[model samples]
Target: MEQRLSYLKQHLQQNDIGMAFIQGKANLFYFTGFRCEPHERLVSLMVFPNAEPCLVCPNMEVSLAKEAGWQLDIIGYSDHENPWEKIQQFTSDISFQGTMLGIEGELLSFSRAEQLKNAFPLTEWTKLDNIFMDLRLIKNEKEISVLREAAKLADFGVEVGVHALQSGRTEMEILSMIEFELKRKGISEMSFGTLVLSGEQSANPHGKPSMKTIQKGEFILFDLGVVLEGYCSDITRTVGFGAISDEQQKIYNTVLKAQLDTLEMCKEGTILGELDRKARSIITDAGYGDFFPHRIGHGLGTEVHELPSLNENNSDVLKVGMCFTIEPGIYVPSVGGVRIEDDVLITTDGYECLTAYPKELQMIK
Candidate 1:
């Protein structure tokens, strides 16, 4: 937390911003080590180049914030009290008036912006999104450790889904089994809604789980992840319930090849756009060009999706410590879809795949 705070202060000095008001929950947790959901209330971290930082939150959360390892000065207010007025008081004490102010422009609502403008009419406000995004882009050692554990749990999720498969089971029943097993193992929540799409429903890339029952000679897609220690993991796998057509086998092989080839291309100095195109070419050559849709993958970390997107147009280059997913899929309406995804970590020499559930097309009896 101290290292993160020092970085933020250095950035503020370099940018010549007098003060930064951080309100995003993720950003707050990143800098202060305190995470909270401040819904319908004003919670902020006030930082200055030379002065000490301060945390403002609901009066009821002052103790909770301290327990979370935030040692800075804390200001609390009740629901009836005007938070903007309290903000003005804090700013006045630090002489933060008529100078450059930095804020999360992307997160601040229009009403909140107006409130800030009305509070400090003479202050100049600048957007701090880029500054903070860059700060959290690379994962530190501690963060990487948490993410590794999260990936293990995500692999466990797929394992459970595959074992729960049966011809008479509905998509929802399988989904319930996955969640129930995770909960039994002490998992409180999933990184995202668990996805268990079967047969024709698998054709929709982001389809919701339905009551449709599994059948012989059909495909089932399992896409899920778990949140462990504030980090997240996501993975997808498609397996056949029983005997499948030769065309289905061909499609599955094509997607698997695309995913495997893309993972091989994931190394330091690799351009994200070219990596995406390499995978796309494999699926295209297999005569499923139109069926393969969506970007190659996306950044993964604290949020299921983050920075350094993996797509055909992204010019970002892969760097060590950067984590993202490599998911390649071929969706055909009225038939079925096949997708194989894996979480990958960019390493100094090469790359390491975090999610290790078998990608081989499995047939469940």
Candidate 2:
């Protein structure tokens, strides 16, 4: 916690902001060890240049915050007190009186952002969106340990999901069974809703499990992950229902080859855009260029989707100690779709994969 605080202090000074008002609960909890409530009360934090941090939280949660390991000064208010007043009090002591304040621009609601500005009429506040995110790009030892555990648990759950696939079964039935098996394997719960799409349904990249039953010669996409120790793991694998045609096998293999190609190039300091291009080019060569959509992958961490996006547009270079997903897919509206994903981690030595689930096409009878 002290190290994290030190890093944030450095970031605050570098950005030339007097103080940063962190709004996103996920990043807030990481820095202050306090997770804010929803609309019931304003969960606020104030960070001044070269100063110890402080949190403005509901009085009811102050004790919980202390218990969970709050290292800096804490300020609390009762429900009866207007939430804005509490925020004002927090900012008044730490925030610079007539200078710009910083908040997370992406996560804060427009109304809430306006309310905050109104509260601090004397101060000039800005959204230091990238300032906060910049610190989390590289993982520390503790973070990597937790993510490794999340990967193991999530990988086990994917295997369970794969075995649950079969013909004459509804997508929802397989979903229920996989959910049950995941918990049975001691994966407390899925990080996100399990993706169990069959046949034409798989054509949707994020298709919802439906009453549609499985059949022969169609693609089955399974994208699932497990949440453990506050970290997340995400992997996607598509399999053939039964006897797939030559065309279907080709599509499946193309996606598989694309993922494999990207995996070899995910190293420290690798250009992120070039990695996405590697996968896009491979699929394009296979004559399924338009069908293969979305970025190659995204960075994975506490919030599941964090920094270092794997896309044609992202300039964030791949760095050692950063963890992200490599999920490349091909979507076909009627025939079906195929996607094979893996969770890869950049290490000091070389990159290593956390998701060890078999990548070959499985044919469930």
Candidate 3:
């Protein structure tokens, strides 16, 4: 955390920015080692170019922040108090007129921006989102370790879901079993909603689980991930319930081949856009181009989806220590859909596949 703060401070000094007000929960945790959801309340880290940084949060979370290893001044305000006034009082030494302030423009709401403008009138506002993205683009050894564990848990989730599969069962019934078993293993949160789409429902990429019953000779898709120790993992797998059609087998093979081919391109110095193009080309050649809608993958770490999106237009080059997903799918309207995904980390030689729940077609008899 200290290193991250120092890096941000250096950037502020270099850019001639006087102060930075960071409010996003993920950004806060990245710099201060403290995480909280202050819904409707103002919680931020006030950083200065030449002065010590201070944490501002609700009065109820002061001790928790301290326990999170934040060794700095904390200004805790009650629910009724005006936090803007407290901020004004705390930053009295700094001149607001003509001063440059950095903020996350994407995460900051319009009302919040107006309040900031009123609090520090005449200050110029700049975006700090790109800076944060650059800082978190590469994962260190410690982060990779946590990601590895998170991926293992995600693989376990798929294993449990596959075992719970049975004919005539509702999608929600199997979905509940997956979460209940995860809870029994002490996992309290999922990175996203657990998705259990079956048969024609799987044709929708972002379909939700429902009471729709699972039938034989159809596909059951499981897309899920678990949040472990502030990190996240995401994996997707589609399995056969019983005897599937020949066209279904061909679709599954095409998706698998595309995903594998894309994974092989996950090496240091490779262009980010090429990964998506490779996968898309393979699927298109197999006559399923229109069905593959989304990009190849997205970066994964503190958040399930982060920087360095893998699409056909991204010019960024892949580097070692970069982690992202490589997911390819074919969603047909009436037939069904098939998607195979994996969490991967770029290495000097090639890449490491973190989510190892088998990609081959799984037939549950």
Candidate 4:
């Protein structure tokens, strides 16, 4: 903890940044070790260059914040005392005059930012998106351990999903089955909603569960993750119901091979974008390039999507202890889609595969 504090302090000093005000849930947890409330409550975490960080929250959460031993100072706000006034009173006393403050650009809203500007007009606000992104690119020992287990729980969820995927099963029923299995594996909370799509609906990556039932020779897509100890793991696999056509089998094989080939090239010091390109190349060569439209993969940690994205534009280098997912897909619109995802950890030598569920085409005939 002390080392982390010193590291952050030195980073702030080197950058000549005055303070980092965090409003997002994951950001607050990473900087202050407090993650109870969502970002909606107007709570902020202020990290100064050489002093103990502080947390601003509602009056009811003051005790809970104290229990976490995160913030050195806890400022409280109440409904009786105007929330905005309390915020101004608290920040006005701080050493914020003429200081260049950093804020989470994407997570902090325009309304809340306006409030901060009105509170301290002299203090300039800089976006901290790149700064935080760099900090969270590499994972720590504690983080990797939890994510490994989360991957196992996700694999367990996949087992349930495959079993529930029978002919004539509704999308809602399949979701319930996966949730029950996740709970059975000790994953009480989900990192995100379990996605269940059958037949033509499977082509949509973010499609919600519907009343559609499984159709013979059609594709079924399942994307799910389990949260264990605030960490997350995500995996996606497309299976066939009943007898599958040879074309579907060929497509599934192509995606699975692409994923494995990409993982083979992922090592410490590898370029993130290159890894994404490598995956894309294999799928493109197989003639399913147009079907695979999204980025090859993304970073995985405290939140499912963190930093150092694995895409064409990201130039971040892969490092040891960093965990991310490789999900390559081929969506044929109304015909169906095939995507097989796996959470992998960059190791000192090569890469470690965390999701051990089966990737071969499974027919639930």
Candidate 5:
């Protein structure tokens, strides 16, 4: 955490930004090694170019912040107290001139930003959203290790869900079973909502799991991930229940081919657009061009969706140690949909797939 803070301090010094108010929960946790959801409270990490960083939280969370490894100054306040006043106390102690202040524009609400602006009326505000993105794009060794373990649990999630599948089982029923089994293994939370879509519902890319029953000869889709040790994993798999039709098999094969072909091209220096095009081309040639709606995939890490989105318009080149997802899908409105996704780690020569759940079209009896 200190190393990350040092890097940020260097950036601030280089940019001539005197102070940075990290209000985003993710950024706050990343820099301070502390995690908390300050729902309506004013929680922030105040960092200056030369002075030590200070954490500001509710009075109740002061001890929790210390337990998270923050050793610097901590300012706590009650619900009735104005947090900005306490924040000003630390700034005044540091003799903060507030010439140039940085903040996360994307994560900060307008009301909060207004309060901050009022606090530093003379300071110039710079948005550090891109700076944070660039910093987190490449994963360190420890992060990759945790992500690898998270992927295993994601794979396990699919395994449990697939085995729990049976004719007449409602989508919600199977979704509940998957989460219950994962909890039995000590998984306290899912990275995102567990998705269990079947038949026509699967055709909707972001469909919600409902009481719709799973029937034979239809596609059952599972897209889920688990939050393990502050890291996250995401994977998607679709399988047939009992027997499926010829057209259904064709759709599934096309999606699998697209996903596999695109994944093979995931190596260092590969352009993001090239990968998206490769997958889109394969699916387009198979005559389902319009059916593939969303982008190929997105970057996955502490948050499921992060920087360096894999799409046709993004020209960013893939680099080593970067972990992201390569998910390709083909969704037909009426008939059904098929999507095969995998979490990939960019290596020197090629890439390694973190999510190892099989993508073969399974026929559950």
Candidate 6:
């Protein structure tokens, strides 16, 4: 945590930013090793260029923050108290005129921004998103270890979902089973809403699970991830409930080939855009280009979706220690959808497949 804070302080000094107010939960955890959800309350980390940093949170969480290894000064406020006023009191001794203040503009609410403006009326506010993104784009050994564990849990989630599949089972029923099993294993949160779209509903990329019963000879799509140790893992697998048709098999094969081919290119210095094109071209050649939508992947870490978007238009270069997902799908409104996704980490040589779930088409009996 100290090293991360030092890096941020250097950036502030270089950019002439006197102080930075980081409010994003992911970022707060990144810099302070403390994860918190303040909901409507104000929770932030105040970082200075040459001075010690301070954490601000509700008085109730002050002890919790200290327990999380935050050894710095903490400014705790009550619900009836104005947090901006508390922040002002803390910085009253520091000079603000002709100096710039940095903030997470993307995550700051309008009302909070207004309050901040009133507190530091003479100070200029600039975005600190790029600084935070640059700091978090790469993962360390500890982060990778946590991610690997999360990926394993994600694999287990798909395995449970596959086993719960039945000819007469509804999507929600299977979805509930998956979560219940995860809870038994001590997983407290999911990266996103558990997706268990079956049959025609599977054709909708972001469809919601319903009470509709799944039938044999249809496709069942399971897209889910578990949050473990402050890291996240995402995996998507589509399986056949019973004997599927020729067209469905062909579509599934095309998606599998695309994902495999793209994974082979997950090496250092590979352009992010080319990975998407590689998968897109294969699906297009198979005559399902239009059916294949969305990017090839996205950066996975503290947040389910992070930096370095893997799209056809992204020109960012892949580097070692960067982890992301490789998901390729073909959805046909008339024939259901087939998607295969995996969590991967770029290594010194090539890449490591974090999620170990089988990629081949599975026919659940």
Most accurate candidate by TM-score: 6
Off by over 4 Å in 1: none
Taking every candidate in turn, the Cα RMSD to the unseen true structure, in Å, is 1.5, 2.1, 1.2, 1.9, 1.1, 1.0
TM-score of candidate 4 relative to the true fold: 0.94
Cα displacement (angstroms), candidate 2, residue 217, comes to: 2.7
lDDT of 3: 0.92
Clashing pairs in 5: none
lDDT of candidate 6 over 122-238, digit per residue (tens): 889899998898889999999999999999999999999999987778999999999999999999999999999988999998999999999988999999999987899999999
Between candidates 4 and 6, name the one with more favorable lDDT: 6
* TM-score of structure candidate 5: 0.98
- The local distance difference test score of each candidate is 0.89, 0.80, 0.92, 0.82, 0.90, 0.93
Model 5, 1-365: lDDT tens digits are 88889999999999999998998766787788787778899889988889998889999999999998899999999999998988877788788875899989788899998998888888998999998888889999999999999999999999998999987889999999999988998899788999999999999999999999999888999999998767789999999988899999999999999999999999999999999999999999999999999899999877889877999999899999899999899999878889899999998879999999999889998
Cand. 6 Cα-lDDT: 0.93
Worst 10 residues of 2 by lDDT: 32-41
Candidate 4: tens digits of C-alpha lDDT, residues 1-365: 45665677787788888777877877767776666754356678777786777778888888877776664878788756666676566666765567888888888778888887887688877887787777777888888888888998888888888887766789989899889867766777888889988878888878888888878888889899987877789999888888877778888899989988898988998888988898888889988888888998888887898765789778878888888899998888767888899999999989998999988888887
TM-score per candidate, in order? 0.96, 0.92, 0.98, 0.94, 0.98, 0.98
- What TM-score does prediction 1 earn? 0.96
Which candidate, 1 or 2, would have the higher TM-score against the true structure?
A: 1
lDDT of candidate 6 at residue 293, scale 0 to 100: 80
Cα lDDT tens digits, model 2, 1-365, are 67777877777688677777876767877787655454646777777776777777778888888987885677777867777776667667654567667788898888887887788777776767676677777888888888888887777766776787766788889888877877776776577888889888999998889999888887888888887756788888888877988888889889989998899998888899988999999999999999987999888887778887888977778888888999888887888999888888898776999888889888876
